[model samples]
Target: AGGQYRLFHRADLIDLLHWAARRAGVRVLLLQKVREVVPGPEPLVRLASGAELCADLVVGADGLHSVLRQALNGDEEPFFTGQVAWRAVIDNPTERRDDVTLHMAPHRHLVTYPLRQGRQLNIVAVQERAAWVGEDWRQQDDPEALRAAFADFAPDVRALLDRIETVHLWGLFRHRIAPVWHREGVALLGDALHPTLPFLAQGANMALEDGWVLAEALGRAEAIEPGLAEYRARREARVARVVRAASGNARKYHLAFPPLRWAARTGLRMAGRVAPGMMLRSFDWLYGVDVTEGSAARSRK
Candidate 1:
């Protein structure tokens, strides 16, 4: 609540994670895709390249499409939420703005924020549609198509959309949190366990929390099984709350009734005027969470 929001490029965040892992004597393996994870008496990882590896404990941090998740909780499909999002990063010719700007309209919203020390601008534009394209994040869309979607936006927004040379569009889908977070010696961390919508921008943050809490819990537990159980117990409730909050945020942003939307906006403006930090303070339960609330020594382990 006291600190400012800092955005990170996906690559830089991963680099930092890898750096910390390596510093802690972790052997970081690259380009090795996990084909399957068998969770039982002996945890196993089968690589796509036909190599099998065994470990004491296997933590799956893989994103939306996780094979490990299927192994633990069966093949559950995610249904589209009738929303499609396009994301692109463009060079920041003007590095003056370093905050998130939201352009909200009925059934659609666009979010822009600076990244990479304001050298790059990150754009997220979401639109509600009847049909979903697909949930694959790597699916590319023509810049012209993106432009067409937001052609009616203000000139400044339109101009920024015009600057996009490349963009990826993905359908927003709702995934049920894996009923079982872990099985045997394999634990699902991050999106593998819970995939929240981008509405709150907490997908990565929650995953980071998941990793830290999982590690901290395991380090404190006497046995691997108990550690994993504790990890799941501590995270499931919190993640569910976040998932609901994110969905609710989408509803608030996509309000269709003109009067309702106007009232909501006016109320927010009045609240900001009356209690300057009221909006953010209301989210203290979220941003103020310290998952590592126990022994630091256990965390170091």
Candidate 2:
């Protein structure tokens, strides 16, 4: 969540993109897929719709199973994380609060947050289990499946599940970070470079961070080569750390032992009670990073 208002929404993200692109005099083409990348001093992208575009630097913002990443790194498959995510959005009638509420239960966790100015709430519930075979992100799942999975959760939480019209289920997957994010004039961005689990809720935020840093990096460079290098150097280790942390979070949130579960919840309550900003401060290193200034200072030195 970007925290633009009290809540975050997909529509808000779209609006931000629309405004930013227009201000930059950029137009985006939707529903077009890149078919191939011709790698060289200058890379050329061949689109499936028989279009060719050439750019000085090609940054792949595509999600998991990125074709650009495949062409650049010789096609690697994403490994399933042995968990499935059931996600949906329910109508938010005016009374819903604007904070994100996360409910953790045995072997599962649920996160709900308002979207569209608290007019709706997006719910994503993840469960750890076996036999989810594929990495397809758009697999359809019935709402009953969600209800059954989360039956023992809090009553208020169960009420939200009842309101879901439909649900999408997908096997969570993880990819090894590309050893190289840049090759000549091409590079990977977002999920292409590091596909993360939803455990940390940092996947989309990381992409936004990537976009912000990337645009700034490109704008600073006198040439594209150093720009790509600088971008990878600044982002690679940081994104990798977040990916690992998200994986660890999944393990922590889904502990099956009763003693462990109670301890974890109790600790969170104590921490939240002791210092609310402590949690916020722990993540300050992430949100407070100034990539442009860091890069500029490094270059000057």
Candidate 3:
């Protein structure tokens, strides 16, 4: 899809959000590790420091391994997708193109895009391998190994890889959406409810949508249960569709058979040349709708 989009550093976005939250008088806590969540009429949050607090409603926006998610629904195993990804940021001195560039190969792909006003480039490389690596994103890997994995890539891509002094490698895993999103004044959002692959670049987008929809649903409802129910109902189908689309893209990008690869490449070229806008329009269902406005319209109706 050919559409104008801007990318920002995660830290910058976080800082902006922190400012907005502070202005709204929201309490921001740091390093308060939650050890347990006791759900009931009034949910209790037990901290690792042995501090306990109760709230009328609790929303868990925690990431993949959410303690609150496990408390609401028993732990379910996450299946490794037989793929691992290395992520790194390198200084961009040449003022690279603002657009994202994807270099695809059999069983692997690399995505590079400029970040921080083109001063840096964010690189995410995924390779399908049998070796089991833990799902921790902070685990460092040898930069030489990443270069070796994509040794056959184009010179431009290789140059970017060469600039990587440090990289973090993490195994990709598919986690089913939580069976129970809301119960007993407790609800889930973001990765705590659905952890999707990065192939579609919609993981963070989906989480943002979840947060907006969750707030809208809760704000309008007279009681917590109904609001939580509405939130799940509005989100589940759309998120599931997005997750499936991302998984399908993973297969499309890693075509190994020569004939299939040729056909796929040719099809993409034809589409880009003949009907580029049509191709972009196809994603209107995914990206066009303003969720906030749509929800308000639905409420009005």
Candidate 4:
């Protein structure tokens, strides 16, 4: 893509947000585990410490396994996508790459990008497998397993993998958009509403857009119900499109047949040489969007 793409450490991003929230007088209560959410005229949240607090609106920004989602809608199952991903971050003091690099192979692909002022590299390797693994992202796997999985990759990639001391393995599972996004005064945001595959790298982007649109709708609406209704109505379709695109990219990257993979790679190389900007322009709908102005205006209308 021709547009500017920046990478940063997840911890650094979270720290920046934490400081910004505190500066804005947003009181963030840490370690307050929510046990139950009771939706009604007065939405009640029960904490693990036996404390019950009532709020006007509750936004669920939790990850893939969300408790509030189960309260708003019943429990639903997530289907495994027959793929697993190994993630690791290694020191890259001498490496400086501003752009993401993807090395693709049969039934597998490895993406690497630098972060933290080019002092660290983040690697995400995905492989198609028949066996199932739990979906927890924090589950650790031996570094040797990750290296063995990509033993046939390029020498440069193998050199990078050799530096990995620890890795996390997680199964890629597909979770559909919740049938109901909001009930009473409780609403879902981010992965709680839609958990996307990592192919398009739109999971965080979608969540940020959702927060923006939801805040805009609620701020302008006369009542809570109308605000939440407008939020879901405006977001649901666009998110569904992005999710479908991500899923398509997953299939395109993981073609196992030799001839098919060769053809696809050749076509991509030809496209890059002939019309480099064409590939970037195709993502205008995604990257070119200005949610604050465009989406907010659409919601008002």
Candidate 5:
């Protein structure tokens, strides 16, 4: 089990969190859409229904189009990264849940992995295009369009695509990591702080880390300002590094030049065969981190 990567289905994970949070006596509210957030000594959250809530501190875990992030930083648009992706889940007859696989070609790539105890396979197909697509991932796209994008892919990949009857499409867009993470009673969390490309598969993980580090920082601080500042200091460098690394991944998969692509693949294959441990160890600083220990130590005098 050492040096292994684990994957979880998003919906299933959310359900688990709901159960855990409620078990811990945390009230879980749904369907109350937020209208705006006002940050100061005491933060205020105004819901669209005109219901208002006050908190000693407001944390924006609202994700990419976060209303709170906009509240703090004002309006700024995230530029399209010239890429779009479609996500779908299909029945996995083969029970291929053990590992993720990637199929790459010029300007496009298909990433597939098993989910839900290998009863289903999750597919994410991405391609480079100049056209602007909406940032919404819930926007449905024709299944045929999905097939056409990877028509020339390996037959196994094509067959998996054939099983996708429903797919949602979204444009990949990046916003600069918010210039500020916390202001008085408010702090940004997760994608609200930084929107990362899917390449590193660390977007959700980063958010989880944010929660751990932020909470630990606050627990050890004398005041909210110092705690929030420490949380940002601990997180910003690691997050920026992650975002930069992920941004470079599209180039690796979408290599347009045949020779360049071959060389890259060849080098990877060689690394896999010769020094696989070293290659994986390169990510040790990332995957090996124990935020509990790090945050506790850093929070100490």
Candidate 6:
């Protein structure tokens, strides 16, 4: 939610869903998981409850460990990214605060964003560590472990973590790019197609863009083949660039060298003071992009 609009919690998804449904002619089904997808002359989907669904086209948005993706492209292993993220939302401090604070230290970063209209704060601390097994997001971590990881951080950071009552920690996993994004009538979306690191925070936004392009391509094409091909061709390069940039950023932000880190911070501080719009303008290719317009419009002779 670092965009122009404010951030929101999971509960706000309801309002978003209602708004989306009203604007777009779509249907949403909850608590239903697609167990398997078979792409063929007629695409077939097997539901968790042994139910079957056949559609002219299938798009997989089930996330990192997408079952539909595994069925469509054969199950592939997910690579551990050697990073763990600890998260929790504590009682908002009585001291009035409106702006979000981002504290970056070598090898670790903490970001706090206002939630529930400033009533609560969403805090996420990410650190690079030795490879950890398991990728369950709901797994809880010991508060001591969280504290120990950031023990060297600033006093304010320590104070905030000290007050946390509940927390969850999960290992991040990176995945290799999909060789074949589409097969027959099956197509992949979001993490299913390209799992990116959290450094860039563009994963969700890219998924949203993919959804729009996928639907438009299908709507315009006479057959599923052309639509799926167009969707993959249009998105692969952009999403690949995003993935590489995010991975590079992870390494760049985790510098432990004293002089280098200092110089980096100083440079950003200077940049913030001078030519701030230039920094924002560098991302025009990203934020100013409108996938609905297609790639041809931006192509040069």
- In candidate 6, where is summed lDDT lowest over 10 consecutive residues? 292-301
At residue 91, candidate 1 shows an lDDT of: 89
Residue-wise lDDT of candidate 1 within 1-301, one digit each (tens)? 2557888999999899889899999997899999999988899999999999999999888989998999889989798899999999998866556688999888889999988889999999999999778889789999898899888899989989989999999999999999988888999888888998999999999998898888888887999999998888888889999999999999999899999999889988988999998987888889888776665555478
Off by over 4 Å in 2: 1-6, 290-301
lDDT of 6: 0.80
Candidate 5 per-residue lDDT over residues 138-209, each given as its tens digit: 799999999998999988889889888999999999889999788989999999999899998999999988
lDDT, candidate 4, 1-301, per-residue tens: 2488868688887898799889989889999998988888899999999999888998888878888888877888899999999999999844576868999998899999998878899999999999999999789999999999999999999999999999999999999998889989889999988999999988987898899899888988999999999999989999999999999989999888999999999988887889987777778988887688775567699
Model 3 misplaced regions, further than 4 Å: 295-301
lDDT of 2 at 199: 81
Error of 5 at 127 (Å): 0.5
Candidate 3: residue 22 lDDT (0-100): 97
lDDT tens string, model 6, 4-47? 64466766865796788868876766688877788887989888
Residue 137 lDDT in candidate 6 = 70
Positional deviation of residue 153's Cα in model 1 after best superposition, in angstroms: 1.4
For each candidate in the order shown, give its overall lDDT on alpha carbons.
0.89, 0.81, 0.89, 0.90, 0.90, 0.80
TM-score of 4: 0.95
Q: Which ranges in model 4 have alpha carbons more than 4 Å from their true place?
A: 294-301
Off by over 4 Å in 6: 1-6, 22-27, 94-100, 292-301
Clashing pairs in 6: none
> Cα deviation of 227 in candidate 2 (Å)?
0.9
lDDT (tens digit, per residue) of candidate 2 on 60-118: 87778787888778867677778988878789853766777788887899988888767
Whole-model alpha-carbon lDDT for candidate 3: 0.89
Provide the lowest-lDDT 10-residue window in model 2.
1-10
